[model samples]
Target: MNDQLLSARDLKVSFDLPGGRQAQAVAGVNLDIAPGEIVALAGESGCGKSTLARTMLALEDATDGSITFGGKSLPKSTKKLRAFRKQVQLVLQDPTGALNPRHTVYDAVAEGLRIHGIEGSNEYDQVISALSQAGLRPPEQYLNRYPYELSGGQRQRVVIAGALALDPQLIIADEPVASLDASVRGEILALFQRLRDDFGLGALVVTHDLGLAWNIADRIAVMYLGRIVEQGPVEQVLLDPQHPYTRALVSVLPDSPVGDPQVLTGEAPDASQIPSGCRFHPRCPLVASGKAAEAGIEEKCRTQDLAVLDADPRNWQSACHYSAQFGRDEVRGTAEPVADSLG
Candidate 1:
């Protein structure tokens, strides 16, 4: 079997705008996830992180791209989408919205099994197993309870149970803990970690929280303007960012040093109005300071869109022409956090 469970290349997702314009939500991107690996795609809101996740899950049609599972290309037909969904599950961001108000927890979880054609006692057994895995103890006590009776955390667990019911190989959780309480967020994150360790399940968690990435993900991919500008092991990307955009992201952390980290000046460029050359050049503090230009790369920064550049020791990659100029990120406080909160 291929080591990679899921792979996507040149992935692009575009939406039709009001004025006959095209809004490319997911620009050219490529990624791979190994079995049992938990990878976090971190980016600011509207950076197309969720869109990319949806495209990977086959929930959204790729405007220009290809997604492969276990080295086989995903099928375009509706019948095959069901088969694909059986192996690849999705956990949406909002539990309240994702769950049905009228249905009990048992009904919510059993729905997937029913759709997939599992019947009778087998469905009951699967739902119980799923709810138990999702941290809802014993399963019987909460089976009949409605969403209104459950806490925010428990409701989210119910959403997770729905995904777990399918016994999927891969789960794409979009903002899994964003709406949960601070205390509950850690529990849910810990659950993700536990699931990865115990079940050997591969997960692609779409989150805006860099802290969450540091807390659990084996690798982190930093996205800017729909492109993965930098990616590698979590420690390398979080502690020693190379791309200017990644540096700015890491420098703002609560524990990072205050040596005037590269504070970006302007808002992220709209997808429809992406800048020429480097998409991030307008907000790139390094380029804004005229350093890259002074170093004789100014013209390229203004006219050439950067591509992913391979770094040493394999896996680690950055997309900036000036990435070679940076060293390890400065972090004076080395106190390890027991848990991190989403911003």
Candidate 2:
């Protein structure tokens, strides 16, 4: 057996607004984090990445489908949920806000252990070990310091230590470095990679920055307006994107340097006003008949929603009317390959 640590199937989270309407924050998203893999969920803000993270951790109720951990379905009971909490931990975007202002760093890191009934010399040793593992050197110096007393990087490290203190099998990091200064972000990214390597931890990292995803993710899942548009090995998806939304996202990536010099255009539809037919057709460059015909793309993009198509079961997959036509810019040896691939 493959022993996947976390799997979310058709996960959807919707909220009822003031009127008799619903806002679908997450819509039918499916993902699996195999043991020790770092799966990044990348997209623009409000694209449902964070919503999906909360749903996976059962922090929010799912409107549809399920989340399974270690082959077992998540239980609905509070007691069972508490047990689930011990196995999954979250590191939020702002470390300063995440920690209690009044508590010492040691108290913050040791809080999880205390709640789980872990105590005494062994737990204290583990607390120090976790802080050290997160690269908070001179662990003793940090133990009594409050959040305001630490630097941004050090405060973030303390939060990471708190998450690690629980001995969690999976960590859900929601833009964990987005709030940090540029100088400090790289170190935090390295810490996450180190944690994954040393502890064999699975991580679900939600971020809008494709460059960061490219740097740290083993595999990438691209989201658009609450649904997964494409997913595959980081290199495969970043180098060769099949979905139009994925292509647009990659076009804007600072490191990609591919696509037309002209800025890609189009706004994501509001969740309440999603369009008919393919939700992306209005913004998809490939949907125009002229482009579609030249690329050998069919009419499916205009009238049908494409199912997730797996070109190679091992890595590549996409939900696009003409995914087969798309090729990596690297493969074509042109930063802006003739829109030929869109067919």
Candidate 3:
């Protein structure tokens, strides 16, 4: 944590909603990305992972808390911020929409360089190197190609190449592989890994896929209802999830070791009208199945609002009140009958 390339402390982002209410998009998130480390922010769609990513990129401002990159607070001046952005690049999902259809691969790759006024006799060389680094081998072959000309994977690589051309230290990829085919998803994920291994590039991959996190991330942070409910090493958190939300997500994975899949009832609550106490209590499997009452934490679970997880980033933490009790038989469904199974 001391050597974190980018860190967000108690970060919060909110937006004005209809009526007099506000949507809490990101609420009190503490995250760190060390040099060369890959951290995946895993969650469902409405959990605010993308908002957190955008906040880190300075595309969205935090309503509270602080964000520091390279051990310094984010710059305020436009000139300074522009320089800061050169070090932190964003790779968005959907390469098709990301790229300019009329632009050639060369143009797409060189666009950032041009924007940052990085022209020189070797600008062309920089584009080629970036393209090659992104795994578009023998880069020259693809330079004249348009976005429509390349396959989905190739188009994604071009998007990555554009980011790499700026020589960024960190990449904040928002669902980078969401639009790709299954075969191409691995290749793109592998490309991200190679970037880290080869260049010591740190990345925060925002995703809803726990499987993707298990495959590519060094650490995983499970986000729910605008907060990180569980976080630790990829194996520790995913294999022995202490938070019910995390457990539910891991259980649905194809290779989940946590017994049967749990079908959480109802949709995620609207951010504008978040539930009191535990924001996830309404959809929590344990609450619906009577396990919480059986364990005598139902009242506390329903009425006590939990704070952020423990401040220590090195240790695994879960915000649930009875996280320690999660080791009980109920997790594996071996105990006597509860009221009903998860919907």
Order by lDDT, highest first = 3, 1, 2
What are the candidates' C-alpha RMSDs? 3.5, 3.9, 4.1
Give each model's whole-structure lDDT: 0.83, 0.80, 0.87
The deviation in Å at residue 318 for candidate 3 is 1.0
Q: What stretches of model 1 exceed 4 Å from their correct place?
A: 257-261, 308-314, 324-343
Q: Where does model 2 exceed 4 Å of error?
A: 255-257, 293-299, 308-313, 324-343
Tell me how many clashing residue pairs each candidate has: 0, 1, 0
Error of 1 at 161 (Å): 0.8
Per-residue CA lDDT of candidate 3, range 230-342, in tens? 89988777777778898888778765667677889999999888888788999998789888888898888889888876435588888886665665344545423222222
Error of 1 at 193 (Å): 0.8
Regions of model 3 farther than 4 Å from truth? 325-343
Best by lDDT: 3
Better of 2 and 3 by TM-score: 3
Clash pairs (backbone) in predicted model 2: 295-343
